[model samples]
Target: MIPARLAAAALAAAALAVLPAAAARAEVEVDPTRYAALGDSYSSGTGTGDYFDETCLRSNRAYPQLLANGLGAELAFAACSGATTSDLLSKQLGSLDAETDLVTVTIGGNDIGWAEAVTACITPLTDCMDEIEASETLVEEHLPGLLDGAYGAITNRAPNAAVYVLGYPRLFNGERTCGALKQPNVAEQVRMNQAADRLAEVLQGKAEEHGFTYVDVRDAFAGHAICDDVAYLNGLTYPPAESYHPNEMGHLNGYYPALSRAIA
Candidate 1:
């Protein structure tokens, strides 16, 4: 009887151990009451074109709104159209606090004059490579410290939040240059994509260092670049602010899904 009882106790202990391991493999469900979307144009939905607040270009079609609505969480949308890392620290961080339990940010492009570089690429006689090379140098030299300051501020403000630092998508398909006038050629497009890749690499490292999840959307937007049949990003649009930004479908299909997969 003693031997039989001992075997039964050992079996029960093993079952308990197995249950925990099984639970660990299950999906992570983040149900936060206070969610803050803080960053630049990507989070603001600049290219989507249905802006409720023109100053910030906040759109209903943006990924933040979509994600917030999906999770049934109250959102403090603080992203603006032309925000840099410095802009994020000064203007956007106001939305986050200790009570905030979820935060998502996509920044750092504007810091290195990404838009200006694209403009130079599209201008008739300007040397695009020189401008792109300058931006790349800033990415290597200066953007890290700027990101560190912004990220540190976020962690400090939202101590309990599950923060996600989202990276930018590669804007070009790289096979064909399809836009109208003075568009980046195939070779230029390839280099631009390489710059995007470098930015993602930097963003991923900084995010991980700060104990936040880094969501890379390059893979998500792979076949959906500007020249693709079903392009997620805008290619030199009319209101130049919208140029090179993700359209509504991009937020829906690319950014939102990448973020969803990260937390889900």
Candidate 2:
């Protein structure tokens, strides 16, 4: 009964309305071809092996590279040894692409500069705990904001990318079995770990907000804890040449767990 012109117009209107619904219903494209990693020491395998460069910046042993290795994805690890959330955005990450299929980040460790802070307070566990605790106020104020921004930049830069934010591995000697190396107070380890937990939560929240994936490494490093049956770290007692970073075995333990969850 309707005129042909009116019928065409009605069909066009219906199409427009349906278009938005279809777009909303459309599944996100996830290709595991080209990938990139953005973050700091933990992801870069600082104490690990040669996954990338030569400097103290560490090597290709980085976990993100591990992820790439298993996924059969091409990788460009932009993860520096001491990267921050800000680094993820401002020329901070490199070799990225609009068509990148996957992206991962392991940032925020350097924000607290906990390595240096802990190194400075190594001789005084109570003081290190106190100093690290005081910095929480600052971390709470800024780390989330930085993560949110980093998430935005990552998604914006690569609209079709699948992003996965990784968490830091356990650093403290919970069982206090580092041989001659004095272990940190168990209470202090818990305190520092709480901060690390909060950091992972922040990154995970932002990743969820922006529709990216998150990989938590805490549980993965449990038995491999610095003082566990075997050891992951070389103990805080050794010089920079020996300690402060994950050993080769540490990277293997940390990387497989995180990469398994992400790639699977």
Candidate 3:
């Protein structure tokens, strides 16, 4: 018979040997056969260049494309610029189906008039507070139902898919910088970030209700927000449409990796 000490040693060694295999199995495993990308401008990659077309403005550098490529999954790219939650229910849900194995979304910005608020906040002499306050009202009263409808539609369309709802980053680092274009003051930035936080909270709650994963990018974008030395988000740019949206690197380093970690 084996000695008690020898048996204990053998058991310890066996447990250690089993750990590495378990860790290997635990490594990021997203092998989607068919992926669907849904939601608004962020998902469509409006700020990132190299669009598939003017209609959807689906960029090659979008996180969805990067994720699909990384997983070697066939993608149904339905996200579009200027898309509202209503648009998701009406237009984007067509791309998803039971065959879709994975899905990702970034919506609610347009619904809350995020672009309009940002425009007011950054533009010289504009009373950004009014826009922000109005957005806050929408956030409290209107956004929940809108998000529910949109998320519900997504689940219905992709009943068997693993859905990921990605939230937007807070666009500012609570700093003020006077560059070629006007920047939102520290106060404006703080308020806007607060609004963004509220939006994210709403998005997360809805995503959770639907049994979908909600990936928050606020921490991922902490130092990379506008006014940072190396901003992943675009400051007021020429195209105007790209203003305040995540850049190519933001999608690559921020959104892509955030979603990757969530999937893992």
Candidate 4:
């Protein structure tokens, strides 16, 4: 309806108004660069690679590292095997500093101390439960204090980081195993997983109490639990090597997605 010259002038002005807004949107991108990880064997990729450390303490393929690889984030994947909540508060496993960007942690299974209890008493269910009961007593007695200390450490050091407390994945599925050893009795196995879940809950609450984010990985591995995947998880019946550790599939496929998003 308007003349061609008039219409063109109006269109040009509108276009100029929107161009600055578009440029602002493009400039408002998130640069997720810094990342750090802390935790136990579940996060450490204990048995996946041939890194060959004196102890099965750390692995190159740990979920945190996998996340780093997938996202191309600079990493400080300090996850270690046999880590406990207390270790988070100490310098035994690794170090923590002030400039960390993102922090992820997985632990508390060893607090239940199921390895020694189950390994030493695999033959007797009653004795295993008794040992677990005793360990539970010890853990319960000191668990809260240890968690408090850990939260204090992370908050004290990386006050600005987005710290995530990752939950442990279920280690066994029903009556499965690695070999000769029948694995921890099914009931005990359930108890152990439940204990780990409880520990995660405690850690999550504690982290929140200290201003950190907590990511629950238990529900994420629902169907893919050791019982469901015959090939993926290390079942006790197969053998006793990594009876309680995550299988390779568990480390790479199961946890990577759940954890990477948080870290990334």
**Superposition error at 91 for model 2 (Å):** 3.2
Displacement of residue 35 (Cα, Å) in model 1 is 0.4
| Model 2 Cα lDDT, one tens digit per residue, 21-58 | 76746554333467787787776777765544754365
Worst-scoring 10-residue span by lDDT in model 1: 1-10
For residue 126, model 2's alpha carbon misses the true position, in angstroms, by 6.0
Instruction: Give the range where candidate 2 is weakest over 10 consecutive residues by summed lDDT.
Output: 1-10
TM-score of 3: 0.87
Ranking according to lDDT, highest score first: 1, 3, 2, 4
Model 3 Cα lDDT, one tens digit per residue, 1-264: 222322344565566667877664544433336778998889999898888877877899999999888866788999999999888888888898777778889988888877888888888866799999999889889999998888888778878778899999999998776567556888999999999998888889888998989999999999998889889999888687787889998999999999989876
Please identify model 3 stretches exceeding 4 Å from their true place: 1-32
Q: Candidate 2: misplaced stretches above 4 Å?
A: 1-32, 124-126, 177-181, 237-242
**Model 1 stretches with alpha carbons more than 4 Å out:** 1-32
Could you say which candidate leads in lDDT? Answer: 1
Q: TM-scores across all candidates?
A: 0.87, 0.78, 0.87, 0.75
lDDT score for residue 100 of model 3: 73
Name the better of 3 and 4 by lDDT: 3
Candidate 4 lDDT tens digits, 1-264: 122322344565566667877663553333444667787777777656544453645666667777767645677766667777776566432455555566777766677665776675466434466766765665677666777777777777876567777776666554554345555667777776665566666767777787776777776666676557444455554334456566677777767777655543
Off by over 4 Å in 4: 1-32, 52-56, 92-95, 124-126, 175-178, 236-241, 261-264
Q: What's the lDDT of the predicted structure labeled candidate 4? A: 0.64
